[model samples]
Target: MWVTSSTDKVLTPSAIALGNFDGIHRGHQKVLQPILQASAVIGCPASARKVIRDSQCPYATVVTFNPHPQEFFTGQSKQLLTPLPEKVKLLEQLGVEQLVLLPFDRELAALSPQQFVEEILMRQLQATRISVGEDFRFGHKRAGTAEDLRAIAAKFGVEVVITSLQTCQGNESEQPTLRISSSAIRQALAEGDIDRANRMLGRAYTLMGTVVKGQQLGKTIGFPTANLQLPPTKLLPRYGVYCVKVFLEGEGENIITQSSIKGVMNIGCRPTVAGNTPTVEVHLLDWAGNLYGKTLTASLEKFLRPEQKFPSIDALKAQIAFDCDLARKILERST
Candidate 1:
């Protein structure tokens, strides 16, 4: 993708879309549609695909951040819906022509709202138009509001589009649709409410990581697991064993296969084994593989059971067997 770190780089004719776009949920999609529409209407240079290029695109480019602004500002780095790489992947899938991943550092944080527009959006991107949420803020101390953005656009000879918020209630009970937020999504996951989280996310929440070598403890007990080394910045669900579907990346292909193996995933420190740190271990049923040192992406489709202490290994094994059967039933019903 066309990832430019320096804003000083000049670009071809382009419209700009701006946001953190954490989950790229339905609300984000709504915001982006009009930006693309305006780009098409402007008759700018032909849309250039940026799969592997540094050249700026002639059409729409989505500007987002790495080490999320919130993370940089408040040190609240946990509970991310999508990390930079995954967010880029999703944006590309959605047909973004170019992507600018600005590193959110102290210097970028100190620019005044007007300077941000003149420098980044106008001079740097030469943005013919800019789109963002109503709550969008910019410049040092977040002094710029949507009105400020509109004023900047008028002065800079650019158009400004402010998107409305998207909200929805669960299961047709429309008293009031819950607010779309990363915090709300995290709350749902923390409470083991995958259904509610999915409603906010518009898809299942996924955790990706490299599979690490473990002590073969699961195999010894007849339940082999793929131990994942989750990134420190990645958000984790509530501590518990869950029912999940595992997917593996294939050679020369971008598709993932859902292993037929039903499994129970534990998301916590191995208290029973006196482990120091938390681990996510999955035991696949009716399947076997040599998965050491491979990257695996696991999706928590549903919450099956809570984490608890078993008196002995034998007892733990029996409970795990039961959990697998229960997980299979839950997944079967879901399909």
Candidate 2:
């Protein structure tokens, strides 16, 4: 996929999907499908020709804002389900051709509704058609609604597709339907409801980071761990130990190992060791390799236990050992 800044010159007309798309959850996929189909038809490659019939297609593009408009306006760091790089990777996997990451600053935030449509959507992106969720809002102070977008799009000879809000069947008996949203997913993660979050995401929740050196505390305790340094804006699950599957890949290399290793991960400030800084540390079972500087993607399988301050180092070690044993059993059963 071609990634370009929004300020870059617009060469091709596009059928764009508009949203923050933090998690690219099922609902986001529903909104993106039409745009993906339109783009696939237009830019059908030789390898994809067998799947997509020959037809004129516009550029398949995703127009999203950076720093999340909420973060920009509120001056507070907003945790994100998918960071910029991860979001780009997800879009590419979904067959998006281009990603236009618009800078969301005070200047861009001040644009009137009409100015946003005339400038960014029309002049900059040259959008032939735009797809957005029903509740999507844009322009200064979110003054523009999906209806406003449709009205403005008509004047520019652009087609606007507004998708209705999507819901998934609830797991509980009392509530039959639950809205599938990024906010809902965030709330689930915040509350350590891994199962519900994964269901809404249509995939396991994963945290990707570069392995960094730590104090080697886990190593001394006989459960060596790879310390991960995640992006500051990345959203983390509730602080605790979790059953996880770890994927390790080389730095600056496209090679990804096919098999994942079962592991136990801790996300918290190590209170037992009198540590105050929060960290993500994972110990892969039966794995032996140096992962320093490598990228590791850890997918949360289940919540094990909350982080706590053990009375002694021995007690902490014992608890971790038990956690690992349980995690292994859980993972084995799943397999």
Candidate 3:
């Protein structure tokens, strides 16, 4: 998708979906569908025949905030379900033609409801139609509501579509209904419920980062690992060993495909080895190569065990061997 700032001039009108869309979870899909449906009727560029017949068709744009408004206002560091680049990829896969990542600062946050609709939506984006979740609010401490959006947008000849919140049945009998949201997915991941988080996300929970050098303790014990330095704001599953698939970052024509290798990943401080900080270390099964200075995307499949402090290095090594064998079997079954 063509990405631009909210202040950029729009040459063509757009049918836009607006939200934080941090995780782009199933509920976000409901908010986005109206824009896609409108795009199809308006003739997006991808369908050449339709575009040829309707030259004035509006582009499908997703307008999202960066750093999340909560993080911006509170200045608190928190893990996000999906980072900006990953969110962009997800939106593109959903057939969005353009993305407008608006910077959330004090100035933008100070705009009144009417000013936001007139200045950003109508004047800048040229939005012919706008879609948002029923709970969506904006402008000056969220003074604007979905009802406010409709009234203000109409003055600019813009159409407003509000999507109802989506929910899924709870897995446990105690809780019957659960709203699908980014916070819910984060809670699942923080609790190490990978399956539930994946179900909510519509995909596996993934971590992407550049490989960095570590203490080389894994190599000394016969299982060499590539340590990953992840973004500080990226949310992590509970500290544990997990079944994962690894994809090496590629250059030009040598792009590596996802799930090209199966492995066991440890996400924690190596307590048994007297390590102090949490780290992501992965050992590729039956594979060896130089991975320093390369990026890798690790997709978590299942949680195996929590990080522990073994009595001895030999005992830790033996436990790792068992973890590897278990991970191999799990990966095999998943395939």
Candidate 4:
């Protein structure tokens, strides 16, 4: 996607979509369809035909925020569905033509919904049309609902579309009718239900960071690992050993260098090793390469067990070997 800093830089007529778009889940997809369809009608070509017409050459843009506006208002707190970079990558994959990242500070947060619509959406983006979820609200106090948007949109010669909530089958086959939200996904991750979390995220939950040097205890145990210094700000799953897939970031055309690997990861302080700090360490099955200064992206696949200290180093080694074998079997079976 072509990312634009400000609305002023948007050179083409635009059909805009609004959302935090945390995970870009199915619910977000429901809202996105109309905007994409409108774009297509306006000569904003589909996936392959990325060209545009002169008058109807509509630019598709998504307006999102940084520092999550909720951090300031809501009592709830947790990791984001996708960080800014990851979010941008996902939007690009979804065929977004432009991305407008708004800095959510005290000043921006205080804008009344009408002012935001007039200044940012109508004037800045020059939105010929706009789409969003039915429940979506904007402006300082979230006083702007679909009705409010429609009322104002008419005055500015803009068209507004409100998408209905998309429902998916939930427990006991009940229809869970709500948009996938970062808050719900965070709760699932906290509970160690990676599968449910993935359902909401529209993909596996991942942690990406630089591989920093750690105490060489894993090497001594014959199971060297790439230690990731996870950001304190990022959401982390329940601390435990899990089956994971590790890959070197920016290695190739592949989003994940390797589709996945049968591997074991420890997500906690090494209690077995005296005085070790909390860390994320992954040992890729049947692979060995220098990774001290490299960056790695590890996606947790399944939670095997919680972090535990074995009686002896031999016992720990034995457990690790078993874990590797189990992971291998699981991977093969899944494939």
Candidate topping lDDT: 2
lDDT of 3 by residue, 16-51 (tens): 899988888888888888878777764344667233
Candidate 2 lDDT, 220-294, residue by residue in tens: 989999999999989999999999998888854543686889999999999988888899999999788888889
* Clashing residue pairs found in predicted model 2: 42-57
Give per-residue lDDT, candidate 3, residue 307.
85
Off by over 4 Å in 3: 9-11, 45-55, 172-174, 252-255
TM-score head-to-head 1 vs 2, winner: 2
Sorted by TM-score, highest first, which candidate order results? 2, 3, 1, 4
Q: How would you encode candidate 4's per-residue C-alpha lDDT over 1-335 as one tens digit per residue?
A: 77766556765667888888887887787777766777776434575346434546577778777656787667456466667666777778787778887777778888998889888887777788888888888888787898788888889888898888765445553346434676777777877877677776666678777788888789988999888876566677877888877767655344336566557888888787764667888898987766666677777777888888888999999998988888778767766
> What lDDT does model 3 reach?
0.84
Check candidate 1 and list the clashing pairs.
none
The number of residue pairs in model 2 that clash at the backbone is 1
Give stretches of model 1 more than 4 Å off: 8-11, 38-57, 75-79, 171-176, 252-262
Q: Kindly give the stretch of ten consecutive residues in candidate 1 with the minimal lDDT sum.
A: 48-57
TM-scores for every predicted model: 0.87, 0.92, 0.91, 0.86
Better of 3 and 4 by lDDT: 3
Least lDDT summed over 10 consecutive residues: which range in candidate 4? 170-179
After superposing candidate 2 on the true structure, give the runs of residues whose Cα lies further than 4 Å from its correct spot: 46-55, 251-255
> lDDT for every model?
0.76, 0.87, 0.84, 0.76
